[model samples]
Target: MDNTTLVDNANVVATPNGVLPLAASVELVCSSRTFVPFLFVFCAIYHFLAPLYTTPKQLSWILTTVASATMTLVSIPFVWDYVSSGGDVKSVRTLSSLTYATTRMFQAYLVSDLIMGSIYYRNQLMLLTGWFHHILYVFIVQICIKRAWTQIFCLCALMELPTFLLAISCLYPRLRSNVAFAVTFFLTRILLHLIWCISYLIPSNRTHTTGGSILPSVMLAGVFPLHAIWFKGCVKGFIKRRKENRALAPQAVTVDAVALAHATIPSSTSDSYISFRSASHNHPARKDYSLSTLHHIGYRLWPARKAIYSFVGLGRQTSS
Candidate 1:
């Protein structure tokens, strides 16, 4: 860490060698606007490339890829440095250029995901934790930055290692390693998270936790159930997708070029009927409306005469 200077009443340290001030990263990310938009653009590009995956699944995978890569990258180094340096010099206020940048990136990613996920997973979204968890995470991370709990923030980010491993397995089943995913999941989310919630038992290490004492305990303890719920969802999704692929292997895809165009029919007097946009998709299609878009439009038009086009031999099974 470099010599700390009181700049704007916030501790400022020289870059590359010293601690990077939290305010600087936040300002760089917030004021420039391009920093966060680039993240969103990255997801958009991934969505374009991953045509085989379903809408929600593509979005989910995109976020997981970026997050797991960023969080794990920053966290491993922090943990290694602290452990190797004998841990005597490390402090709660020790913010790294990489860690703060990571935290800010995470904050921006969550915010962008809230907008994008709400659109894709809006109706099917969980009131419990699907999008709400993102909101809560943004808050907790903000608190970590505000309080300068850099080390605790790094550890909390490390807990996502399990999610990332499973995500890789899902993205590429040919390279799937359930054993590695399970070990990391249990070690990080189950064991390490539980340890964080109970760290108060060790008075010496208790102070190292963010929020002094109560908040870290309460936040992660409360978050344990969420981890269980989400983990179960991920497992079910993985298994279901595997079974789907197996079933799809023997079948043949049927495609058709039917005349279809965008339309806007009035639903209510308030003019809520907007254009039902159709875009190119990977799966077989009946004209412009592919299976996925068909599903989307059907979802958009609930109960009020759903567009059920029974194209013969299309063989529809939703893929993730």
Candidate 2:
């Protein structure tokens, strides 16, 4: 019985598949043995940058940053070794390419599974919180990314896009207040999903075929169009609300001014015109008082009250 394994850190053999094939050479180099270091380094960088948003505590930030940075440093050598291995897939020759490939792929899939599976675990959490919406949003993003039509470069850009958007919202006070900024964020996110779904539906290269997992891809595809409908509704609502507010705002301001005028007008005035003149201080009848009439009244009578008290033999009292 011939066994399959890597030899001399290069080449894979099926025991009976001939003394290692040249076509498998690239596969051997790319397998788990060589890929781990790079994968770990990439994961480390991600974790380091991960605490950037969700967590607000300083301690979590510091710990995650330090841990990720250290792991990243340690992963570098493993990456360099894999790179130098010269694309060989022999069990004993270069390194066990199969072992490395299998391990890393499993690790990646495991992480994905845990994340995807946990979404609907609790109904209460789903119904009452924004977490579900955000999770769905993320799912929409992933479906788009994994779609056949998406470019690898756009996937990279998508990964960085959230971080940048979060930073803009947090750092720039004006972005928080900006309706345009909010619309941009929503549209771009939808656009990403649309591009990904379209990419899957229409592959860039003619030779590529759908892997036949219709259920998952289709579900992901549906989200974008649904999102488009939702986005339109939001735009309509915003416009309607803005128009209503503009119509009501002037009336509200006028009502407020009228209320203020009524409150400040003296209740003792006998004539409406005289009262208006006194309150506004615009007419010549109120030339001596103006807006500081209350102040003038107090200043004029303050010293007379003191003199009257003094003549009554009342001594001045002081607080310690």
Candidate 3:
């Protein structure tokens, strides 16, 4: 037979092999036809209330909270089953009610969020990453539902737990929440996801009975690195902030030291003041002062010199 005929025959042969029946059953109960209208209604309500929010971030918080909560509810039961089954690949290959609901809800949220983001925060969409992710997720979920790959989609959905935490951190800006989010993201989105994908793609598991395909594996492999890169950026940002705070702390101490020296200089004719005069007379040129004398003078004269130089510099800067 020719290529097309062979492909057609294979599909026809595969129809009775359980996937077709499951796909039909999932469609009958959880049809996209049923989902699209609900999505539209939710979007309408969101849009009507959008003006109530003072900022785009507030609106995002509400939407992300809804998505996160739904996914969390779905993931709890799904995860329990997977673990209880001893990480059996077959456990994830079958679609449960929980998985179906999670998939549909997430797809709907992505569609609504995409529209809301485009309309309210068009600049963010221009960044391409957020826009691409929403579109890609929606497309992937739709394909999975239609093709009886709901179990695989649920495996992907596990990443949403961390995504929810990330949204919480963004909305609240708490150090604890951000730390939790980062750790959860690393565990779920990076480590567990990598393990799951590897298990799914094992050569022994690629049989027709397993319903495995290269496309899902390739898509997941591509996503894994992107997630890693994003997590690395989060780590780098945290480190940068810490370094900035540390640098600022020393400068603050130096400023306080300078202020104290200035206060004390006018009150007393101390040894430091005498030393400054003796060194100035001996050196003549300020530049020619010896290292030891400079150090001695700086120990007492630094605060006064810093304050005077700062005042002079400020005056010059303001005048210019």
Work out candidate 3's RMSD over C-alphas. 14.1
Candidate models: Cα lDDT each: 0.61, 0.41, 0.65
Select the stronger candidate by lDDT from 1 and 2.
Answer: 1
Highest TM-score: give the candidate number: 3
- Per-prediction TM-score, please? 0.55, 0.34, 0.65
Number of the candidate with higher lDDT, 2 or 3: 3
281 Cα displacement, candidate 3 (Å): 48
Colliding pairs, model 3: none
Going through the candidates in the order shown, the clash numbers are 0, 26, 0
RMSD of each: 17.8, 15.7, 14.1
**What is candidate 2's lDDT per residue for 1-320, written digit by digit as tens?**
32655554554454455555645555444544534554455455445654554533221223223332343343334334423654111111212333333234333332332232243222222332234444554444344333432222122123223324434445333554436534554744575455444544543312242344343346546555655665676678779989997787656645534443344333332343344444444332333333465355434323344444554667376798
The TM-score of candidate 3 is 0.65
Ranking by lDDT: 3, 1, 2
